[model samples]
Target: MPTILTFGDSNTHGTQPMRSRSSDLPRHARRWPVILGEELGWDVVEEGLPGRTFAFPDAEMGPHMDGRIGLFIALESHGPIDALTLMLGTNDLKAQFGASPGEIAQAAGFHLDVALSDEMQDRHGGFEPFLILPPKPFAAGCLAEIYEGAAEKAQAVQDAIRAQADARDVAVFDANSVVSVSDIDGVHLDTSSHETLGRAVAEFIVAEIVEA
Candidate 1:
């Protein structure tokens, strides 16, 4: 079976939407990466971290949140995967970052730059770098205060991502077309959304990348 890597933040990490940080975690069977693997019959390597940012060093989460460095580490560690996925920027929406929508997309551009570079291509022996644009976050739950004024910015990111995909020539999938963030906390996926998103991503990859 071919290997595919899912790289991103909490949603990709299978964070179950909730009001507060708790011990509860989504089961592997429900996580999108697992679902994608099952649907595609491929080896899925998940490189997801909560609070991860596209290129920013998080305040509470510290510098480890920088995806540029994390992605390089993941790519080097996993090597020779058949393909890879990028889903990020939502964390950058945190009020702490004080980043604008365009800035967030610009960070994503930087990340794509690395992914599409000679080093990463050589590391993976060449594979499609797919971008998964997340749904607009609703700041109406426990994270409301943390994501204040984030809703509008989140919406803008979708367009920015699509534009970036066209400019970069990377295949892109809009998560909003399949699943929105759970209303419970407004930043993470519900169980059903996770399942739905997993299937959607599987179909998208097959049609857009594999069979294209």
Candidate 2:
């Protein structure tokens, strides 16, 4: 079976709607990454962290939020992966970060560049880099205050990221076409969204990447 490294942020970490506790190891059969493995019968390594950002080091959230470190770790830690999937950047919209969608998208492209690097690809025999654009979050629920004005910025992420992914000639998928973020917290996902989004991503990969 082929293996895939799904490196992403909280949503990929299976964060449930309405944040209140710390994120633990992978769970939820309905979680998209879990569903991804089930639907495709492929080995899926889930690497997700709360508050992870592709652009900046968060002050309040801690320096660990720098996603580049985690991306390198995940690539080095896993072996013989056929693909690496990146789904992140929403956290960059934090009111504090003040990052524009274009900057966040560019930062995300950095990961694609890393995965496609000759050294990293050779380490795994070879691998394809895939980008999954995160669904835009609505500013509401407990996170409303922290994510103030995020929704407007979220509106432009898809196009911005698409432009970057296109420049790299990487495969990209828009998660919003299939599922939306949970209305509960706007930052996390509901079980139903996971089930739907997971299946959607699985189908996209199988049709576009695996069988293409």
TM-score of each candidate structure, all chains considered together:
0.94, 0.93
RMSD of 2: 2.0
Error of 1 at 175 (Å): 0.6
lDDT of 1 at 56: 88
Candidate 1 accuracy as lDDT: 0.86
Which parts of model 2 have CA positions greater than 4 angstroms off? Answer: 19-29
Candidate 1 segments exceeding 4 Å error: 22-28
lDDT of candidates 1 onward, in order: 0.86, 0.85
Worst 10 residues of 2 by lDDT: 20-29
| Candidate 1: residue 130 Cα off by (Å) | 0.5
For lDDT, the strongest prediction is 1
Report the lDDT tens digits of candidate 1 across residue range 120-153: 8987888888999987787877788888888878
